[model samples]
Target: MFYRHDNWRVGLNFKNLFDKKYYESQGDWIRSGAPFTVLGTVSVEF
Candidate 1:
C-alpha cells in the first residue's frame, strides 16, 4: 500500500496471494507456479 501527495502518487500491490502451487528447480529443470497476481500504481511528477 502506498500513497503520496504534492507530487501525486498512489500505489497498491498483491502477488501470489494464496494461489498455492509451486515447483521450481534449475538443477533438473522443473518449473510450475506463479499464477495469481494483482498490482496497481500511478505516479505523476513535474
Candidate 2:
C-alpha cells in the first residue's frame, strides 16, 4: 500500500482523450504514440 499527499488537490484528468484506431490493414500506419491515451495533473497547497 502506498500513501500520497492528502491535501487540497486541484487536478485535471483525461481518459481516452484521443479516439485513435488502428487496423491490420494499416499495421504500419500506427503513430509513435498510443491511442486512447490519458493525461492528468494535480496540484495541492497545504
Candidate 3:
C-alpha cells in the first residue's frame, strides 16, 4: 500500500488465476467470466 498523503499510487491485480471455465446466468440468459486476466491500476486521492 502507498503511504498516507501520497500524490499517486500504483497497483497490480491478477484474476482467474487458474483460467477455469464457468457461467453466470440470470433470467434465462448466461454470461461468462474471463478465463485469465491481468490488470494495472493507478489512483490519486484528493
Better of 1 and 2 by lDDT: 1
Q: What TM-score does model 3 achieve against the real structure?
A: 0.63
How do the residues 1-46 of candidate 1 rate in per-residue lDDT, one tens digit apiece? 8899999899988877888889878898999967789899999999
1 against 2, candidate with superior TM-score: 1
Q: Which pairs of residues clash in candidate 2, taking residues 3 or more apart in a chain or in different chains?
A: none
Q: Which of 1 and 3 is the better model by TM-score? A: 3
| Candidate 1, superposed: residue stretches over 4 Å from native | 20-35
Model 3 whole-model lDDT (C-alpha atoms): 0.78
**Model 3, range 15-38, lDDT digits (tens) per residue?**
888999988789999999778888
Alpha carbon deviation, residue 16, candidate 3 (Å): 0.7
Per-candidate TM-score against the hidden true structure? 0.35, 0.26, 0.63
What tens digits encode model 2's per-residue C-alpha lDDT throughout 1-46? 1234777455555544666555433655745444675555666666
**Of candidates 3 and 2, the better by lDDT:** 3
Best by lDDT: 1
Q: How many backbone clashes does candidate 2 have?
A: 0
Over 4 Å off, model 3:
1-5
Report RMSD for candidate 1: 5.8
Candidate 3 residue pairs in backbone clash: none
Q: Which candidate comes out best when scored by TM-score?
A: 3
